[model samples]
Target: MGRGIVKVWYDPEGDFLEVLFEKKEGYFRETSDDRVMEKVDMQGHVIGFSVLGTRNLAKMPLEVALS
Candidate 1:
């Protein structure tokens, strides 16, 4: 694994949260969890992820495997 600057954004009105591991061109894709989406680069390497209903997460922890 490598480490670099990580970017995170939260939309309170939309109850959404997005995180980026790298500032690269990528698209969001469905994960096992419907509320979770993974962003992958052109080579299909995971570069980020998004979560829906983030406010609801206060009741529990959010956990998802990113490939």
Candidate 2:
């Protein structure tokens, strides 16, 4: 485990949300859910995640495995 600041961002116009556990280069990949994406480094460790259609979450809670 590592200790560091976690970053969160939300775009009202896009209805999207993103969270980052580490500040580094990574690429987003598909997860079990289509609305969710996991960002991973070259080594495949989960560094962050993003959510699409965030505004719809109010009607149904989002649930998806990161790794």
Candidate 3:
């Protein structure tokens, strides 16, 4: 599979997360299928993460993908 780079911005008050990534040069969705949305499972008790995207380096807050 082709790999894409992603940057995520989290907002506590907004209760939502925004992601900016380099889509496979010209594909709609570079990482997963061709959609811009996905699901995640939270695994901790924290407010935010200080890591990069949701890869091995992703420090998942509560193990959940910020929605």
Task: Return the TM-score for each candidate structure.
Answer: 0.87, 0.90, 0.27
Give the per-residue lDDT digits (tens) of candidate 2, residues 1-67: 2578889999999989999998879899999889999999989999999999988888978889888
Best by TM-score: 2
Q: Which has the better lDDT: candidate 2, or candidate 3?
A: 2
Report clash pairs, candidate 3.
Answer: 41-63, 42-62, 42-63, 42-64, 43-62, 43-63, 44-62
Ranked by TM-score, the better of candidates 2 and 3 is 2
TM-score of 3: 0.27
Better of 1 and 3 by lDDT: 1
Error of 1 at 8 (Å): 0.6
Of 1 and 3, which scores higher on TM-score?
1
User: What are the per-residue Cα lDDT tens digits for candidate 3 across 1-67?
Assistant: 2245556776565445544443222211122322234332243222222322324233433233433
1-67 per-residue lDDT for model 1 (tens digits)? 2477899999999999998998889899999888899999999999999999987787866777887
List runs of model 1 lying over 4 Å from the truth. 1-3
Clash pairs of candidate 2?
A: none
- Rank by TM-score, highest first: 2, 1, 3
Q: Single out the weakest 10-residue window by summed lDDT for candidate 2.
A: 1-10
